[model samples]
Structure formats: C-alpha cells, structure tokens
Target: MHVKSQRVFTRLTQLKELILESDLFIAEYNLDNIQFVQHAEDLLIPDGKSLSDLIGEKKFRKIHKIIEKSFKVDLRQFEYYLPLLIVNIIGEAILTKDYHLPLDIFLWNFAKESEKELDGVETYASQQQIMQAIKMKDQLKMVKDISKRPYIYRKNILKMAKWYEEESINLLYKNGKKSLGKYKHILLKKRNFIMADRFEELTLNQKSFMAVGAGHLAGQHGILKLLKDKGWKLKAI
Candidate 1:
C-alpha cells in the first residue's frame, strides 16, 4: 500500500474496533450504529482531504454520495468527510504486513453480506401477475383466497416476506458480508439470483462496500463463512 493508503487502512481498522466494542450495548445493534460512529469531521485531514484521495477522489466521493442517499444521513458540504472514513478503514488493515486484503474480496464480501440481510425477494411475475388477473375485481380477502390456487401457495407468501427482508438488508448493509443459506433449499435458485443481483454494480478486483441486511450475516453458509472458504481473511475491525 502507498503511504496514504496505509493511514486509511489503519483508520478503517480502528473504526471496526470501535463498532465491535460498542455492539455489545446495542443488542446486536439496537439502533443505527452509523449515528454513533465518529462524524466525518473526526477523521481530520491535512489541507482538507481524508485518505480516500489515495485511492481516487471521484470514486471515494461517489461511494459516499451513494451512501448519503441510501443511509439518509445529512452530510455537510465539508469535503473531508468521506476520505476520512476511507482512511480510517485503511489504517486498520495496515496493522499487519500481510494485512493487504484484496479489493475484490471486500466488494464480493460486501455483496454477500448484503444478501444475508435480504431474506427473500419475490418473483411476482411468476405468481402475482396471474393471481391478480384472476381476481382483479375481488376484495382483499377474496384476492388472498384466490391466491390459494395452485398459482400461489403458503410457500409463495413465505417467499414474499423473504423478498422484503432480503431487499431491506441489501439497502442497509452494502457490505455484502451476510449469508444467504437459510433460504438455500427453500427458495433455491431464486436466492441465488438475488445474491448475484446485489453486486451487479461490481466487477472483478473493484473494491467497494455492499450494504446488506444483518440477519443474513450469521450461519454456516453466510457470506463471511463463504468468503473464508474462498480464501479471504474476515479480520476483526
């Protein structure tokens, strides 16, 4: 890593440490942890630039811009905020000489983590379209009753909820570290499709965060475990 990158990696690690340390009080995250983390101003810069500059200013800013909208945080016009976050994260990784993690690893892991949070995503075209057409004029209960036809099942209802959950997770985490194994056998290929969709924005070797749902982060087939199996270190902070 370059001199600037080293600093950013170190800070990233420290940020991780802070989150892990504080998660104990949050009930596996009782509230939005981002609000509690250091503000952008906290990651001071010289001449006003955080470490994200070392990577690429546009990329750094773009990531933050995406986050600002998704996270709904009101970041100020202060230019240093995003770079500081990147620098701090990079600093954490520099603790060990071998701590240089692959950019693809991070991006891929982020996408995976994201899917874990999205429990299920619906294939409405496959079911809802036909079901709705059959009962276009029916009342809510009547529509639901018609859904019981072979076109839809208790299984379909389960899938709808899963879709909502998984998408929610993806929107939040963007880290892609969560797992999608829970729905593996139940939803099978549908689950696979969502995981792949989460990182369509990514390419091989590009490093980026993938905000996903927290519920997807645990379990044996989760993103963390999957990444470890594929040979990437899921370091603490």
Candidate 2:
C-alpha cells in the first residue's frame, strides 16, 4: 500500500485523515525479526587471514599500539585513518555517507564508545577530507543531519522518500541506552513520517505505507481503515 504526505512539518492528519480511519493498512518498513544483530558472536568473524575477520587477542592488542604509533607520528593527519579504521571495526554502523551529523559528535562518540577514552579534545579535519569521504548517497548523513539539525535536515527525509529504491534505510537506535529512549521514539516517528511522505508512490490504490513507528501512525487510526472499509474500492493501479 502507498501512504503519501502533504506538508513537511505539519501533522499528517492535516493532509489525509481518512487514511488513518482504515486500520487494515499494509505498509513498508514494518519491523519484523530481521535479526540485524543477534548474538555478540555474530559480530565476530574469525580474524584468520581476511579483511572480514575480527583479529583475535594477539592482533586486537596490537591495534592500540599501531594506532598510538600512527598518532604519535602525526596526530592531526591521523584522523582520516582513525575514523576509517573505527568505522571498519564498528561494522559500518553508520547508515550512509551523507548522514548529516556534526563531526564533533561522531568524534566524541567513537572515542568514548570504542576506546572508552575520549581522545582529540579539540581537533577536527580538513574540509578537503570531509567532503571527499562524504559520498555513497549519504543515508547516514540523512539520519545524522536529521537528528542534529531539524530545520535544516528535515527536508532531506522528503527527498529520500521521493528518490527511494528497494534498499530502504534500517535505523538501529540505542533504545536501552540512556536518554536515547526518547530519541529512539523520535527516530521511529521520523521513519513513519518518511513512509507517510512516500505513501502516494506505493502504486496500490487505497494503499497503506507501513513503517517502524506504529505509535505515530497508531494515533492516526482514522486513515487506516477509511479506504476499503468505507467501500472506496482501493485498487492496484
């Protein structure tokens, strides 16, 4: 089903109230047991002799020394390599390259999370490197920029819905971690909001755009069952 939106910041009901009244809506981006990260073991591949391998104890120990030595040689220049290695180690958790997050947030986050010690108190990168690395259509930028700056990055979500493909974004939020719970709900709402934005593209008439945040759409029940139940003869166009 396809659920479309009207305005950017306005509540979706202002655009289409009947869409919610109909509950038998089928939408995309529903959260099923996709198993993104099941067991901690799943995150670890044997570091035998491959890029995909997670180096065992001996190799793991050496990484610190290698990075430390690299930094000693030239701390300022090492940032490029550091973030790359960090992203590699974290399994490319960032959704996309264009995710619009403040660079400082990521720098602080990586230092705290991975090493458990914040490094580079006040350091950033050359604009050259940042612009160079920011490629790959920037889905990560989409989320990051969204979270960091709502007024500026909010519209990107609408653009994403317009140009979407089969590979819809999958957000992995920190639900059980700190104040991130509230933020997680926001992310879910944003996810649903995006689906709703792209509702008109679903192809099926009287369609529904399913997404992660049922809560956001849950309250808008008016539109959910409005189509078929009301005998609108919603069809596959």
Candidate 3:
C-alpha cells in the first residue's frame, strides 16, 4: 500500500480500517516477539561485534560525527549504532506526539497480537547494512527537506519501484564507493522469494493481510509477483 499522504491522521485512519477488516495482520517485523529485539541487536552489533568492527573504525567514527552534528546525539553514550539511531530520530520527527518513540512502537500498539513478523533476523540485518552503506545520507536529507513545498517522497518511491520492477543492473554504491550490486540482489530478490513462500504457507487455509514495504510489492522479483506465479489470486483492496 503506497500511501501518498502528508497527513498522518488520514494514513492512520486508513490503516485502522484495514486492520479492523482483516483476520490476520502481517508485518515486516513482529514487535510483540523477542525476535524483534534480537534483530535490533544484530543490526547494531552483529554477531557480538561492535559497529566499528563491522564498518571500519574510521568509517564508524565518521558516521558518529555526522550523527552528533545532525541529530545532536552522541554515539558514545548510546548502545546502538548509526542506522538504528537515525531511524529512531526520523520516526520521532515525523510521528511526534508529546514525547518521541520509535516508529515500531506505534505499529506495535496499533496492530498488537495480530501482527506477524516475516523477515528473518539475518536478512533484516543485511538490509540495514545495505541501506546504511548506500542511502543513509539521502534518507536523512529527505526527512530534513520534507517540509518543503511539492513533496517528492512519493515520486521517489514510484521511481524506485520502476527501477526494481525492471530489474535494473545499474551499479550501486556503498559508503561513496561503487559496487557490482551483488548484495542488493541477494538481500532483496532472494528475500522476496522467501517472504512469498511464507505468505503462501500462511494463507493456505485462512485469510491474511500482508503489509510489506512498497518496494517489495511491484518488482519482477517482488513478493506479489512470486505469489501470483504460485497461483494465488490477488486483488488490491
């Protein structure tokens, strides 16, 4: 569901209506389970290694400086790394109400027990690294520039959908260095198939409402296409 809305209330209302109409709610993560915390830890300190070990100590310090300058948060005091902290800050800025909270907290409260997490911890960790390597600056800029007239967030989402849907082989970047994009292929295409397989298994005997990011819905290797190939009839509501 690609919601092109500037109003949070409208989006929440639409989401609430869908949840009330559905039997089961599926999400990218299950906030109610222990696995969510496990995934969070894996992203911040994978395999019990610090952020400096995953990305070089130099790069980690650079990112730490950037965070300190941009968000006024010092990494030395926080247990988590840059990616998780940036996500929390952006979620708070966009979803503010009296006090700040992680975006997952709102989703957890909204859907409660009906929400079932889909992606494995390893896959989630890999995607977070890929995002941090490639688009962290652009993401932060988007949030900073969000209030400007003629919002481009929805347009950028559509453009990315087209790129993924067509399976474009353009070179991707990691921390300002160009790469062959192999990680994206494995993390995105393979994970789509995995999610599709799980979705099919989940819906074999009952109705289910699967909610994934927009990028996972329209690609040639996307979950929706994978499910359709397996003979599941889908109709957008």
Q: Give the alpha-carbon lDDT of every model.
A: 0.34, 0.30, 0.49
Per-residue accuracy of model 1 over 1-237 as CA lDDT, tens digit each: 122222224345543444333311111111222244345233344456443553356654654454344333322343354332332232322232333442223322333444422111223233223232322222222322322342333333234334333434343222222211232332323333344344332323443333233434444545555555556666743
For lDDT, candidate 2 versus 3, the one ahead is 3
Q: Which residue pairs in candidate 3 have backbone atoms (N, alpha carbon, C) closer than 3 angstroms, thus clashing?
A: none
What are the clash counts of all predictions, listed in order?
45, 32, 0
Where model 1 places Cα greater than 4 Å from the true spot, the runs are 1-184, 187-203
**Better model by TM-score: candidate 2 vs candidate 3:** 3
lDDT of 3 by residue, 1-237 (tens): 222223223345666677666666666645455456544654453355554555567866776666555445555555344444544443333322432333334444566655543322224444555555545444333333432321243344344434434433231112101111434565467667877887776767665666565445655776777888999787764
What are the models' TM-scores? 0.23, 0.21, 0.55
Indicate the TM-score of model 2. 0.21
Candidates, ranked, TM-score: 3, 1, 2
Deviating ranges (above 4 Å) for candidate 3: 1-10, 34-63, 78-105, 113-180
Model 2, residue 195: distance off in Å is 11
